[model samples]
Target: MVLPTFVLSAALATSVAAYDTLLNFHGAPEVETRTIDDIHKAAVAEGGVVTLWHGGDEKTQQDALKEAFEKRFPGMTLNLTVDISKYIDGDIDRQLSQGNVYVDSVILQTLQDYPRWDQEGALLRYKPLDFDKIHPGFRDVWASWYAVVVFGWTNIWNTEKVSEGPVEYSDFLKPEYKDKLVFTYPNDDDAVLYAFDLAMQQNGYSWFENLLAQNPRWVRGTATPTTVMAQANNSYAVTFTGALGLAPTAPFNVSIPKNGFFVTWGQRAAILKDAPHKEGAKLLHNFLLSEEYQSPNNTGMWSVRKDIPAPAGFPELMDVNSTNPIDFERFMADRERVERLKLFFESKIGSAQGLSPLVDDL
Candidate 1:
């Protein structure tokens, strides 16, 4: 499906943002010269604050990134908060609706909000350098959004508990793992929803139906399943490509499926037209997508940049097509259908009390 028209405008804006791209560099490397640091100082001079709302309890990582980014742009500072997940619901909508839109940029799943935000004209369009290099699906058709990182799915098993990892997504259903498999609450996590959505779209409805029938206990937070397995709560778990994903201190490894895998990008960044610090927002926007910040040793993310090598120890997925951009008009047009799927999963997999808060609002 084509992305929403808002994305087209965003893409256009991105293409034309070169004049918007700024730097006051004069000659060679100076005694104390880091462009990012100067940009920070400039923002402070302009009374701008860089605030980002994101999902995932990645405080240590965000704090480190902020310190690093600010060090580069000494005057600039990013106040990052892991906000509530707004992927399939109306909280993000309400924020934009009530005119309480203080958030400058964010990193949330885009399966639902993408085209809708585009339709609402809530985004600023500016492509980072090398925007052309990203794989097709992650590119917002119109450039309203570009992926900063793409994390794929894998069945993570406790190395000490299970000798060999599940070779495919379906392997979780084997009687050996019955009632033993655990996964993130799909209804709560847009990442998990997208994974199961692909299982239905790419494999078949029956395949997903069967996979769920095995009775994997769905729980809150993306990292919970992995932690359970790492703690030996169960022999196996359906989680990110590997244990190094988030809870690196946990004792386990990831196994990517061979036939196909589910890949999702988190940490997509964008600014709203009304963002208080528009210039500061743009500086962070450009920095998030730049390899200078997302170096090869990045402790997080699957870089969308084709030029960058995958981080030091990530396992390669066999089937790696990114999610195609959805048509905003069509997607927003059929919001009910998407909401229904979300509700159905909540009833079937996640806790009624835990997930109802989000599903009811959606």
Candidate 2:
């Protein structure tokens, strides 16, 4: 029974290799196949229920989504929990720690959270059918998350009040526009924060210093600028999430700076590793990226899919000026730098005023 050391080592290595292969083998044949029909049946077999945590303006869209899902799948039910993305992430942390992890899938604008969760092995690594069709910049390198839509953070002005709009960030500093501009406090919204960051990098900190002298009003939420613009409460908003589709009839116009604007990868979605309804979760995840949901009229968002056309009245993504391509990984990883930048801006412009939407009672 005393074999040579080399022979024994070889035998042990072979056995270990075989064990590793067996351990890595994913057992589900249907999961391997990954067709829409297969996922549908699997979802139905898994009691046909999935809960989603969404961070966006999904309040009105969720109902339409539920009806559509039920119509398509007959028995499946979709549960949508809507709130700020940061709130959803906080809930996920609480739920996971408490051993309840109820939300099956998450669709949110805060992409920085996705990488963090995926690193902790919290997200399921399942790429939908059209994952390859998405632009490389929009999806995770490891397939843990994918951008479902596109949107931007930019400036807007009440056209009736100011017939001509400012085409540059510095334009807001003009004497005539002084004290007439309002902006969503950059610190309050990630998109606005990123936009401010980009503006600083492009135009220098002095741009902010001079602009601060204009006495621009600041609000907490990204929607506040557009809301104020519609009410004619402010002549201009230096930054807000650009969505022309919203209130198209209002006497307002939005514009991205010719020098640059921060366009964002909107509402990235991912499944949880321990999703309660695995099949239904995957099915719903894929359905959201399908041509049907990605259509502008249906979702009111620009699609990430290559074949889908740009939303009506919107320029092609390539045709626009997206200042610096956002490296979300680096942005999220360098927390200290971001904090320092925030401090610098606050020191120059002043601490953000008003309550954060995240903290404000719903």
Residue 187 accuracy (lDDT) in model 2: 61
> Which residue pairs does candidate 1 place in steric collision?
36-72, 36-73, 37-72, 37-73, 37-74, 40-75, 40-76, 41-75, 242-254
- On TM-score, the leading prediction is 2
| Model 2 weakest lDDT span, ten residues long | 24-33
Q: For model 2, how does the per-residue alpha-carbon lDDT over 21-94 read when each residue is reduced to its tens digit?
A: 33443332222347777889999899989998877533443577778987877778888776777677888877
Against the true structure, candidate 1 reaches a TM-score of 0.71
* Model 2 misplaced stretches (Cα beyond 4 Å): 1-45, 57-76, 232-249, 299-301, 312-315, 318-321, 324-326, 349-351, 356-362
176-270 per-residue lDDT for model 1 (tens digits): 66666777666665556656765666677777678677776665665556656656444554443322552234346565555654454544556
Model 1, 219: alpha-carbon shift in Å? 0.6
lDDT for each candidate structure: 0.58, 0.69
**Best candidate, lDDT-wise?**
2
- 275, model 2: CA deviation in Å? 0.8
